[model samples]
Target: MGESAKTEETAALSVRALDDETWPAFARLVEANNGVWGGCWCVGFHVKLGKGRTAAENRAEKEQRVHEGRTHAALVFSDDECLGWCQFGSPEELPEVKSRRLYEKGLVTLPDWRITCFFTGKGLRGRGVANAALGGALAKIARLGGGTVEGYPEETDDRKVSGSFLHTGPMVAFENHGFTRTRPISPHRWVVTRTVAPA
Candidate 1:
């Protein structure tokens, strides 16, 4: 590939905030995952899971939220194709934590935003898409005037876990971006945070 082509390829790894105009790309990424979280359409964090809710219903609810501009995410794009996304919002927006008890153990500070979940396209693993999505989310948060951002990421310590289970993303993803652990929210998941400054 020529230098310009290589540059373009590198440029393709970019981040954009989720909005109505960009919803299509986000939907495409989720659809590729068999509707992510069992056709959740990325609403798993926004609302509590019921005993028996249809995937279509969940999808509709999610769409409605997005349509009303009540959704948020940071999309990672490779050229024109969205390859991954990291969901984020205020603490009230994503109030539930996987391990509620542990999360409450060390609540020294209240957060302005929470990094909840992530999804990377199939066959695009190990391409740094998750990291890009995280960077994008942080950039967006900073643009939102900068504040405390929280995340619950699973730590890897010689034990292997599937990326699918790491919906909140890996520990290193937050660490590399200046996040510090506040407490262990689960056996492998920890509550992490970072304070960003607007660019």
Candidate 2:
């Protein structure tokens, strides 16, 4: 955990878009944790669109969706090993966010992408994987044509919140990557956004 080791680890890490070819890596990271939040398969964000199914059903549907390239994510890797992941998509892909009233304020149609979820493996949790994944997701979104990207992140004070409740990440993570808070979604959560500069 020395500065130099941290630097080396950062250098060894890379981020890639989640697609059919990389689905296995993303799957492994989630599977290792028993599908994240007791077999969510990272599909809770879509429940507003009426995705009510058993964990087993959700897992199967998610896998089939990924096979069809229906998911968009940023997968962080250390050499060939997957360390973490961040999910992103057009606003249509990630809907029914928390604090709907606050989130809807000043809403517009231009922000085409939404950064919805993140997951870091057990040992990888505190090693800056989420930040890297955030950066990776933004970079990938910019590469596809920079647009307004939105996120919902918790703003924790001295009171500590468990990682289990941070799947959407924290305010600091988005801020570290240059995202600006758009509005307060809740006392602890805020809507944030960043305009990815064109590549």
Q: Per-candidate TM vs. native?
A: 0.91, 0.91
The whole-model C-alpha lDDT of candidate 1 against the native structure comes to 0.84
Measured with C-alpha atoms, the lDDT of residue 109 in candidate 2 is 57
Query: What residue runs in model 1 are displaced by over 4 Å at the alpha carbon?
Result: 1-11
Model 1, 162-193: lDDT tens digits are 87778989998899999998878778888888
| Runs with alpha carbons beyond 4 Å of true place in candidate 2 | 49-52, 105-110
- Predicted candidate 2 versus true structure: per-residue lDDT over 63-96, tens digit per residue: 7867777678888998878898889988676775
Whole-model lDDT for model 2 versus the true structure? 0.81
RMSD in Å for all candidates? 2.6, 2.0
Q: Each candidate: what lDDT?
A: 0.84, 0.81
